[model samples]
Target: MFDYSKLPIRNVLCLDMKSFFASVEAVERGLDPMETLLVVVANKNRKGSVVLAASPKMKELYGIKTGSRFFEIPVNNKQIHIVESRMALYVNYASKVIQILEKFAPYEAIDVYSIDESWICTDGTEKLFGNRWEVARKIRETIYEETGLPSCIGIGPNKFLAKVILDIEAKKNGIAECKYKDVEDKLWPQKVEAIWGIGKRMQKNLNRMGIFKVGELATTPLNKLKERFGVMGEQLYWHSWGVDLSPVIQDWEFEEEQKSISTGITLMSDYGGEDTEIVILELCEEIGLRLRQSFLQCKTVYLGIEYSKDIGGGFGHSHTMNDYSCISNQIYKECISLFRKYYQGFPVRKVSVAVSNLQNFDNLQLKLFDEENQRDLSLSFALDEVKNKYGKHSIFKGVSLFKNATAKERANKIGGHNK
Candidate 1:
């Protein structure tokens, strides 16, 4: 581990959104972020729907995770206001943020680490943007003005320390740049989990080894870590000391491949019995609409629910079509069937639909027993075209027509009630 306590660390800036999805929704909806305990959830009423983001105050009260729900909040539990996520809107804001970064820093030398985090190489732009600290502040203010998102930036000698300082201590100190001068007294006191990419599982593993904090991780033996975790251990050890040699690379291609597109919503209230079936039906239609829009066929569809308050604890059930399909009805029917098998009478707070192992619809073989199957496929494609041109929900299936149903409730939450 590289110790920067005495040395001056510079030429690195880590820019991160405070609460990306929730902030975008708040700005769009004209909601006051500081006063509200807002959460970006898949479904407003669902109990254990994934909590994409929340305000800082909410974090202090609830310590929410990605899959936490509104009802789980212990303090002012009734104060939880769930907002349904808008992927398109978030992407739009994220693009603007990237544009601001490009205007302030070299595009290629900037690394977009996540949806809300990016690392910019400030080595060359110091003169133009001013000293490292001034440049970071300018970037932060520019992003805030352009996108209305609060960002805490950290500057260090390398990307690793920059990210560590930003992730760990910047918010507490109200500092823009976290350099070597502040490492021992500032960064080293924080918990190990504060380091980016050091999640719960890794934290647990580290804890078992008697490594509890940043200081402990810094002092742990490299040979022991390497023996236990291989290359990842080595990286983690180096990360503890804020030693990151990885260059900020531009043109970083995202790894997601879209064979089928799907979304989920957690209800503000839990549902069982027939209501659960209705939610499943709504998810099927949503997935079906998305599938046709992308011009893909999926042989597998899954319905997942998280009834637990804790993260990473849930059961998912999936069904695969032996014959394979692009037809929405087929996918929907199979999805419902799978749900029936998995429901087990447990109250569901969240519902999700996903289609995987996709194939091009043009290559789909026509069925011999069902003459209408091919016709149904064409109709689905036509409907997809209409929805794509007019906007989603302009046309919806009859099954989802019920007013104030789970689908509508979740949509309102995601669409945001204000804007």
Candidate 2:
């Protein structure tokens, strides 16, 4: 049992754009977002293209939701409109949404969770904006009037509660509030998977432990949870009780000294053999460029390859080098070593590369005899300068010109979709 009276309580609002991409398309077409049957797909030309977003009507009528294949959409449906994703446009709208939030709260008091979701702390705005509910209404109405977009708001005492309420209740009711005292009555009966942080695997694990509902998780002994799932289990136990200590207002800028520099992409089509190697090289180049941009170098290089979903297994492994470097070739070499060692040659659908064990670039120790290493580092910085002055594609390795390479095409895209 915990003392709810002693817990710090604050006003947190989690706002999520309704069917963001599809709604944006609907607004552009002058159609009501909620009434329009729209679907945003990554590639309208490909039958297997994944649906990125589907309007409420589209979902309800056809069961076409995000991750549904393009082919699943009813053919020749006069009411349904299929559109390709325009990430740049969506990002612009997301920025506009944040600007709206900035009017009511300081920028530091807002956290942009994704392109379509954000959390704003309304702790001290009661005098200007009224209570949290009033503020939520004003925000929702203002966003719709200004941008022709619809959103749902969830009000709670903390971030987790706000987000959970938003996902579970506000999406249907438009606006909902969940207080600490309401956790048991409002959230306890829901399945464990309904919680924000608990995924399918964790739900399966909890189910095996006979913890099927939020109340069960809350009532379970802390020691038992800690013994089973370690720190995460402790967090789960606390979260179930509607206890979240995360700050509502904090620095959100990318940290200069990051824990890791990573990049990943899902291939539009399966890639294998030398083609997969080329993809890996491009990923390394991205990681190296990011490290140089941040003035950081990493000692550990990690590579992950996911086989096709039909096959459904993948391998991720990392190798720590003897030296820290931001050179693309060095990272690529380490990544390639890992890929070759663990790769089963299944048609690879996704590839990811990461570099960790980071330190400041200024801390790099130069080897007296390793002049080639110094040259490679200098060349990397030189290339970075060129890319900065011109563009990302202005200077790329010769391998990028290969038929299987995606760097050139990717350079023109935003978030791997059309700009």
Candidate 3:
């Protein structure tokens, strides 16, 4: 039997910005996102465009939320506001929100998970912050006062429990804490999919074994799960019991590990022919930019294509590079080769590019007869300098002039949405 007392218990806080995009839109207009009935869409002109964010009122009253299509929004309603996304503005505000969190936990204790979520360790701050629940409220209130954005907080002993509690209970209750004693009543009733690590595909597998509730999964034989799903299956069983040993990795500590890096985009219209190359190059370039920022290079690339769901099929494949490289041109070359190999002639609505098996520049292995590779590395380094000092668009390649190039349009976007 696993000894609960042996687990490493740290007070981790999972913070989520409620309807972040819509909230930023409302704040920019001097309205409260919690009170406003608003939905932020990627594009106002495209009815099929995805909803970037929806305000709390809009979600509760209209059942419209993120991923809701623009066409589904209630038009002609004077009370409801449907605004186009301004991703740059949201990112700017997100930074300000971070400033507020830094007041409690130093930057080393905070892990910025996404544009709107973070996990913070408050393990040793009881004297300074009073208690965990109080600190959570303070963060929630401080963000609202500083940036006019509402936030939810989940407190737990580790990252997984904190994140899952925020997703299931904190967002609605405002703030929720999951101590070890609260596990059965607070965590068990939720469906498997509602938990943080489990997804739709995993839900189906668990259902096949009649494991519907979190409670059942918590008590199932660990060996059976390990036999079924292997290492990940073991993780599934542990996370089901609200146990997580992962640390909250600070932004300053990102370079130590080589997990993965990826970039993807959903096009406004289905692309065909040469246009696909233009989009793929832009995504690879974006992925390369991120890799270079981390001072890392990758030895594997993955490409994913989503034919419109209406058409019924999509494809994804990965290839390991013969030589590790972080040059945008090199990554693009590999992706184009993959496109040629895997792409079938279908209207493509989305594209994804990923680079993995990362290594820091200090540890990179150079070739003996590799002048061209050296030049590529030097140029990529120079480009990263300009991008960091100026903006991402301050430097551009000839390929960006392609007719379907979207890099210029998205230069100011945070995650493919306009700003």
Query: Estimated TM-score per prediction?
Result: 0.71, 0.86, 0.79
Instruction: Name the candidate, 2 or 3, with the larger TM-score value.
Output: 2
Question: Candidates ranked by lDDT, best first?
Answer: 2, 3, 1
Angstrom error of the Cα, residue 181, model 3: value is 1.1
In model 1, the worst 10-residue window by lDDT is: 410-419
Cα lDDT, all candidates: 0.73, 0.91, 0.85
lDDT of 1 at 236: 85
What is every candidate's alpha-carbon RMSD to the true fold? Answer: 6.0, 3.2, 4.3
- Which tens-of-lDDT digit does each residue in 234-347 have in candidate 3? 998888777887766466634656689988887767889489899898888788889878878898999999997678588898889888888888898988998998888899
Instruction: Please provide, for model 2 over 185-303, each residue's C-alpha lDDT reduced to its tens digit, 9 standing for 90 to 100.
Output: 98888889999999999999999999999999999999999999999999999999999999888877745546987899988888886799999999999998998888887899889
**For candidate 1, what is the TM-score?**
0.71
Candidate 2: residue 317 Cα off by (Å): 5.4
lDDT of 1 by residue, 157-241 (tens): 8887787777666665544555565566666787888777888999999999999888888788999999999999999877666
lDDT of 3: 0.85
Clashes of each: 11, 0, 3
Give me the displacement of residue 281 in model 3, in angstroms.
5.9
Which parts of model 2 are misplaced by more than 4 Å? 1-3, 251-256, 270-272, 303-323, 333-349, 362-379
Ranking by TM-score: 2, 3, 1
With candidate 2 superimposed using the best TM-score fit, by how many Å does residue 186's alpha carbon deviate from the native?
1.9
